[model samples]
Target chain A: MKSLQELEEIRNKTRESVYLRKDRAGIRVVVGMATCGIAAGARPVLLAFLEEIKKRNIKNVTVTQTGCIGVCRLEPMVEVYLPNQEKVTYVNMTPDKVSKIVSDHIVNGQPVMKYTIGVDGR
Target chain B: MEDLSLHILDIVQNSISAMAETIRIAVMEDDTNDRLTVLVEDNGRGMTEETVKKALDPFYTTRTSRRVGLGLSLLGAAAEFCGGSLIINSQPGKGTSIEVWFPMSNIDRPPLGNMTDTIITLIVCNPDIDFIYEHSTPGGKFVFDTRLVRREVQDIPLGEPDILEWIRSYLSEGLNEIRGGA
Candidate 1:
């Protein structure tokens, strides 16, 4: 049986630092995870992105899940928000596509144009 | 949802969206009693009475883009189909707790899928929230609380690859040990 005493101790100590880190600007990768998104395989897609980030040792980029992006038709949508840059929405994401996005956009700082909603038009 | 874990994942999203700080998920499997119960309780913004009533209605939803809230409805239907029931308890600003019961021997009852993956994904994706997962069977019980893990890591984020992988194995091994499996 584990205890919470240690958890509370660390939470108190790291609370200030975690709060401070929130203010630091960085890239954000948000995945839509509403019912529609999940049904369309967003779970695996989201997992893939997280796995890729960790595999590549990508830093300063936060990956999170959102309820929905409003385009259920283009589910498994992933949005990338770069600091001081426009938000790019990628639709119909697959794990393979996520890998490409990680390499082309997240790693190399070049948005994968073909995968973007603007170009895919799906 | 294909399995109970997927349903757990889906319903937990509601708690996350409600801004819950602490979420507790409990799974009780009692083969002798032929009952399996899953309880997901969250300390988040609770819903109003009307919202609670409408929650099980597939046509009712708070989202603007879509009109269907199938998460609860589907779970409710599944519970009923399995000779069980689903209950939602909520009070405004207090929090919401959903209790679902299913017959252990019911053929229609969904399998308790890969809970290790579900818990790991939830913790890794929502690092800020504290999760307490309790699995109880006639043999024994296993409880995993992220608050303790947070203390262990202190500065390291829970979402970190090493931490996530460690948590995954911890959960799988812990469950197996409690279930008396090698």
Candidate 2:
């Protein structure tokens, strides 16, 4: 079993850098996590985003969950909110699509248009 | 949902939606008794007796977005199908607690899939809320309380990548130890 002492060490190692940094306006990635979302496998997609973001050491990006996005068929939906840009809703999300979203949109400020709800015909 | 953990995730979402500040989840697998039980208690806005009664109805929901409220109803059905049961206890302004159990040997009982992912998702998504997760098997028991983690971490947010990774490994390791003994 892992020890809380290790957690303390992690806290120590991470605290300095965290304190040195200024609070900047960051990107927000929200996943739909209602009954429809879970039934359609939103959990993995949400985990994928978290893993991708952590693996790449992307800072200032908050990945969270929302209740529902109104369209039940597009259950596993993801909405990305850039600092000042319009919110981009990505429909029919899967773990496979997380890497590209992280690399293109989150890292390079380019939303993958093909994956957006607009391109998905609502 | 395909598995019990998914049902757990859905049920916890309802608690989060109800503005729960603290939630307790317990999963017990008893080989001697041939039972698998899950208990989730939340310090959220409680419901009236009437609301609790209606909560089991698939067509009943308080949300206006869409008409159907299937989370609790589906879980109740799943429990019944597995020769088990689901019970809800609530008092307005106090809180709510849901207990579900299944016959361990039942072939139809869904597996308790990836709890690590479910827990990680909940913690990361709702960093402010405190979650106490306790899992017990015939061999041993494992308990994880966010309050202790919060105290140890101090100012570091639980959602931080490193912290989240640590939590994931911790839970996986802890759960594996108990399940391995079983």
Per-candidate DockQ vs. reference:
0.30, 0.86
Per-residue error for B91 in candidate 1, Å, reads 2.1
For candidate 2, write residues B1-182 as lDDT tens digits. Answer: 99999999999988898899999999999999999999999999999999999999999998998788999999999999979999999988778999999999999999999999999999999999999999999769999999999998998989988888889889988998897833
Over the true interface residues, superposed, what is the Cα RMSD of model 2? 1.0
TM-scores across all candidates?
Answer: 0.86, 0.97
Tell me, by DockQ, which candidate is best.
Answer: 2
Clashing pairs in 1: none
lDDT of 1 by residue, A13-80 (tens): 65665566677787899988777787787778878888888788766678888887888889889999
TM-score of 2: 0.97
Off by over 4 Å in 2: A20-22
What is the C-alpha lDDT profile of model 2 across A3-46, one tens digit per residue? Answer: 78887899998997676544678899999999999999999999
- How many clashing residue pairs, candidate 2? 0
Among the numbered candidates, top TM-score falls to: 2
lDDT of candidate 1? 0.86
> Which runs in model 1 stand beyond 4 Å of their true positions?
A1-25
